[model samples]
Target: MRREEVVAQWQREYDSFLQDCMNRDWAKIARADEPNRDWAIMFEVDRSFINNAKSLLFTIENRLYDVLQFLLDKGADPNSSLRRYNSDRRCYESTTPLIEAVKIGNLESVKILLDNGADINFCVERNLSDRDVYFNKTRIRVKEPSDDLYIKPREKRTDDEKMYIWKYSTGELANMSPIQIAYNYRHDNIVDYLLSRGATMKVNIRPSGIFPFPFTTLGEMLRRCKLYFIKEVGLCEERYYALRTQVREFESTKKLLKGYEVRNAVPYPFRIVSTAVLLLDNSLEFKFQYMALYSLFILEYWNEIINSKTHIAAYAKVDDIGYLICWLVKETEYSKSTRQSLGLK
Candidate 1:
């Protein structure tokens, strides 16, 4: 690729990351034109990236786990508002870090955020209403006019006052609960983990101007549609050991490749940023692409080396490999930080 092409690629990914449906203020604006969303946005708010290269690189490495842990350990409020004072817009917008983390599909980061008291019930309404709406043609409305689910005067409503639908004060979908974000993004392991940690199952999926049912949990959505957020996070007890086994297998396979007279063959490291970039475009069928990449890196590289040299050279682009290694250094530093967190070796 030309220098300009490389620059453009970086620009595209950066633009996507900033205005990503996850981070942007969806607080009640209709997302009619946004193809990924069938739901209308009720409002709009501007968002900007944390552009400090040092800081962003830190996050890309720890994937936000380190900063989250540091904050939580220091008793930083987990439910803190993400108030972004856009000097350009001359306004303020805020959402929680948990919502951000869930959108990015960072499972470990989300786990720490949840454990530290992030609000499970915080909701960003897909669309707001001046009047009550029914769900699935059912007469159940949000139970009150001038609906404001963010109301904090009461500790808890009775069971009769069921969680009908998400309501937002900020007027953006960025306020969506962590679990809903996870499920929408098809982060199955994250969705499951958040539910286990008490994230609410209720999410609003009703089409706008349609009769909205006040009560619908994600569990209900799962039943309503035969969709799957399926994932296997591997063994719990063997998290460390499993990674070791993987490295061992990687080394063993490397030696085997050498014995087969495969020269200059570098096994692809399964670093998140490096590998995840390949499948970023094909997010809906998330896991399948990931599995394909894993197989290609582990099993098919040598075959490509023997049979299709041109494709192998393209696959192992020097710039791409360097980018992966640059990102990998952050992970190594993150591991050191995590080790300190656990007071373990």
Candidate 2:
């Protein structure tokens, strides 16, 4: 009957309302008696982000990407993240949704997070021994409890120092990033998209002993192709998809490389064509065996066709390399007609 009791009851109702929303049961959220609650907590911190008191955005991060867009549109903080937690072990974990998306090779969700300003450099928790992420927080100190002892909780360390330490000792374990995860997962397209959007590839990565990498985006792809060939992995699953999108992305990549205009980089496209050709020599059994041959003619004649002033100007210039290649092929038919009329070979 008292005002405090009434507020408590309302809080309980709102909690239930939020819980439903977190589960993405939109019907239940809409059916709630509290009409204002539907949109009210759209901007509130999702304290239940992890298990309890973690984050709210965790709700739709991976599964309900469209719902995530709605929440972002309605003013949810795009940079929301939570410290890792391992409830089974009752310890902290590093399970941010972006990292999870990258791990799972979900390009769409990864792009959504990155497009909305998710931290691409967000490090995966360094659990070299598979230790709990928050072992430091769990580690009990001397409890000096005074400024004269170690720096007090309220003072001393700069914000940067107060957090994220031991980066160097940990190797790439401490610097695991979204692009690194994508590359490791063989989600080549996600890696390229992340790089184009400014995710740095220079960070130290896991198994650093393997290759001291400072690879450019395309360089990494080519490097991966080389590794696959050396390892004799029968077929890269991505090669199938790569055949569908690589030439388009590859042309776009060439446009990007021109920013440097390094003379050496001029031959980089040719090398990719050649690399595909060499890989095709070994076996036709590899998945996407067709791309190697397809890429060869494109490279061998791209300059000749584009530069010869041969009247490809009639086809639609949609900025699509695939379309351009098809158009070029079609132009050859027209050239044959003109040659026949002129009695040329």
Candidate 3:
């Protein structure tokens, strides 16, 4: 179905659900039957047979604030987690209504959920795919023969010779949190509000690609900026030709230093340079991406770097890069000499 059709259906379902709320036995009317017993084990966990989203999640995704408020008041769980099978990944993925709100870029819905006791730091879990488990390009999984075949030992096969190999697909427990998801989806207002509410990073996502290790959202943003510099600035502008060596060194040093904590080990100058390019760039796309990187830094080291009293002081012991970030973010004036020293135009 088309996107509009799907949205319209959701609206219709929500309307019917809202109307049913006036009835005293609405709970019974919303409860799911068999095949969905796993998720709808409770009365407040009603979901459609179609999408398997909880009523609260569906309402939040659709931005139906009135219905959301009514459901929350009617005892719908603010921290309810829905576990549904992902056909694409061939495994179950878990999501919360708060995550849904963040994904839809609805700050109001996010605030409502958080205000109503939703877990601020909740992370969604998606079961690992075959490629993730094998660390390979192959996506095929070997299907073991039925246990019934093992029950009756074949002519030459002894029962003791046969062993059942149970393969358990490990899921990423530290999946993207609401704040991280907000950053990913470029919801700046939601990111700021989540930070204000004491949200922190809990994600450890590692895609099955060249960089097969977990990195912070800040590190990812830094890498993105570096790519932008290489492609747009270095290749396109003769003025930045001198930066090729610096960029290459930054990439190598980043890879070498990224032992365990990729975020902490990212070279300071590299971080500053990458972030500076993004911050100074005129592109609207880079501006949005910059906000995500900025928000991530705030969450990662708010007290130690961003909001620290000493970091911004004249005699601050912090790295110059940290001071520069804090300084530029505040939009303070920089002397011509200072701008030239940092190679900023």
Cα misplacement distance, residue 7 of candidate 3 (Å): 23
* Per-candidate local distance difference test: 0.39, 0.43, 0.49
User: For all the candidates, what are their Cα RMSDs to the real structure?
Assistant: 23.9, 20.4, 18.1
Deviating ranges (above 4 Å) for candidate 2: 1-62, 85-92, 127-167, 170-173, 202-345
Cα shift from native, residue 259, model 1 (Å): 55
TM-score of every candidate:
0.33, 0.37, 0.42
Model 2: ten consecutive residues of lowest lDDT:
310-319
Better of 1 and 2 by TM-score: 2
Comparing 1 and 3 on TM-score, the stronger one: 3
Which candidate achieves the best lDDT against the true structure?
Answer: 3
Among the numbered candidates, top TM-score falls to 3
lDDT of 1 by residue, 40-132 (tens): 122221111232222233342446555446435544566665445546533343556666677777777666766777677665433232133
The number of clashing residue pairs in each candidate reads 23, 4, 0
